[model samples]
Target: MDQDQQWLINCLNASLDPNHQVRNFAETSLQQASLQQGYGLALARVAANRELPFGIRQLAAVLLKQYIRKHWNEDEEGFEHPIVPSNEKVSIKGILLASLDDPYKKICTAISVAVSTIAHYDWPDDWPELVPFLLSLINDQAKLNAVHGALRCLALLSSDMDDMMVPKIVPALFPCLYTIVSSPQIYDKSLRCKSLSIVYNCSSMLGVMSGVYKTETTALLLPLLQPWMEQFSSILK
Candidate 1:
């Protein structure tokens, strides 16, 4: 490991220390580190390092999520934190998605939250490949960990998506969600439920979009409507 990464691991370990002063000092140092250019990448590396103690890895993932939320975007109203540098943004985005397949559920959840937060600012426009990348993961049923991570992030993103985003996401996503939700033999209950939640949010967005973009939205929804309705009825039963 690089010196900075090792130091970061030490700090993450210290942050969990029972000693109040040690923990506080480590947290303060981490907060300062968050201002630096490579801090997010380092945290991501630490979080994804399977050899590290699970607690430290979990803490790193949590801190990484917090870092993305606080500093990823520079233009939000009242934002004051230093923006993540462009090069570092590219590197961070590249590594962030893979960590979703982390064996630790807590770490996966934290990374999913981080990915969703980044998507809020960068998806489609800055990060055009994200939807397709996530869709690929969701479609790959052989990798359940990746599928779960993708679904979790999509569920969060779908909840807050804009109408413009709906058209891009709904067509590709609805089919995967339906497949998972409808096939009890293939996906377990939790995966089915998460997929269903994303479907609900995407459907809600589709409803909102139909009001103004009737022709386009109808075209998008026409193929998926019957299957979704059937699944909905099954769930209600």
Candidate 2:
């Protein structure tokens, strides 16, 4: 079993090798071994490992995403086959979240995307605990990757949220979101813009909800252009 797992990591790592033969060999190995259980965790483990070469890590992350999208889901038969086991999920989340503090921008982007994918499957019902962790990170200014990854997942969650839950979610969500979008003092311009984008998209979704949420919609829309508008007229202000 240990040999099989190490074999999978080797295949993923080979993609970074300069030799075309080595790279092709790795690809074929993955294609063959991907059918086995525990493959998804192996890929994610490689991606989250800081000791690995960056290029190799990215290949692992991409494979992990592909593996996840193909296999893990709310199945038709309602059977449960978690390719990433329960204990592993917690450990993986911690690694991915901590990877947000990585200095490499590309690594940060990759980790954020992986986190977003995990949130898609785990949140709404399966995992409510992640919400608080992400929210706390969003409020933190010192760590850009943590903020970016957290906000990315939150935006993703809101995008697919049920209309029925809008009332319950929007009131709590908007204020934290507002704090991100409204603050010019935050060092990251990208975070500022992303926060506004979330507000813009969520506002539209909220707008279509029941009459009771009309005030919430109005509250969100009022600041729709403020962040970008401030940027366009920076000298005047």
Candidate 3:
């Protein structure tokens, strides 16, 4: 309702317009270096507003990601250190997660990128619960986007965390991956691919595959992977 928010929403909305010139103008305006902080907050508001057009909200999410990568923690250590304070950070996170479930799926990519960006700075410590929250989404029986978004985010974080964290994290992750990759009832090829990608990334970490080689983990893994062994064996030739 306020004039400032309305302007931000309008700019984001304009970015979604089909006309080339209008879209270009709105895109340029939102990226102005001098006004990034205000613009970023405004866009975060629009991104979180479920009532808005999904395209506009997607635009907001993308723009907010840019702000988060560049400006989120670019300040001194203290209560007001980060350019975006703790309270606002929490609010932005809530919005991004909600958008992950956006029925349209239009905003999934932006939200996933934003989450990965956050995970880079705050994981295993600052955000100990982050992995669990994303895991719940992957395990949820409903909503395809939740699984898709969660898988995308986990893979991104997997790249940053090597074996020290992987051993601890992989146990929780593989069970959900088992459900998706092995069970056809809820199976999705794209989800399966992302799940395997997570496995592959974990294996890349120094000691991660050694942990996976254990008897208990091997038992859980074989059933899910064995059914595909014939196909894999043929491919190996």
Candidate lDDT values, in order: 0.86, 0.68, 0.72
Task: Assess candidate 1 and give its TM-score to the true structure.
Answer: 0.94
Instruction: Kindly report which residue pairs in candidate 3 clash with one another.
Output: none
Candidate 1 vs candidate 2, TM-score winner: 1
Tens-digit per-residue lDDT, 101-176, candidate 3: 6555557767788888887777777778788888888878777878888888888888888656876786678667
Candidate 1 Cα deviation (angstroms), residue 37: 2.4
Best by lDDT: 1
- Summarize candidate 1's per-residue lDDT along 125-233 as a digit string, tens digits: 9999998999999899888899889989998999989987888878778888888998889899999999988887888888887888889888888988998888889
lDDT of 1 at 168: 80
Q: In candidate 1, which residue ranges exceed 4 Å CA deviation?
A: none
Candidate 1 has an lDDT of: 0.86
Off by over 4 Å in 2: 1-9, 18-20, 74-84, 211-237
Q: Higher TM-score: candidate 1 or 3?
A: 1
- Please name the candidate that would achieve the greatest TM-score relative to the true structure: 1
The superposed Cα distance between candidate 2 and the true structure at residue 39, in angstroms, equals 2.3
* Model 1 poorest ten-residue lDDT run: 72-81
Tens-place lDDT digits, model 2, residues 1-237: 378766766777776678999989878888767766667667777777778788878877777666666556645234234455666667667777777666666776777777777766776576767667777888777776778777776666667666654555655566677676667777467777777676666666676763666775567546544644664476256
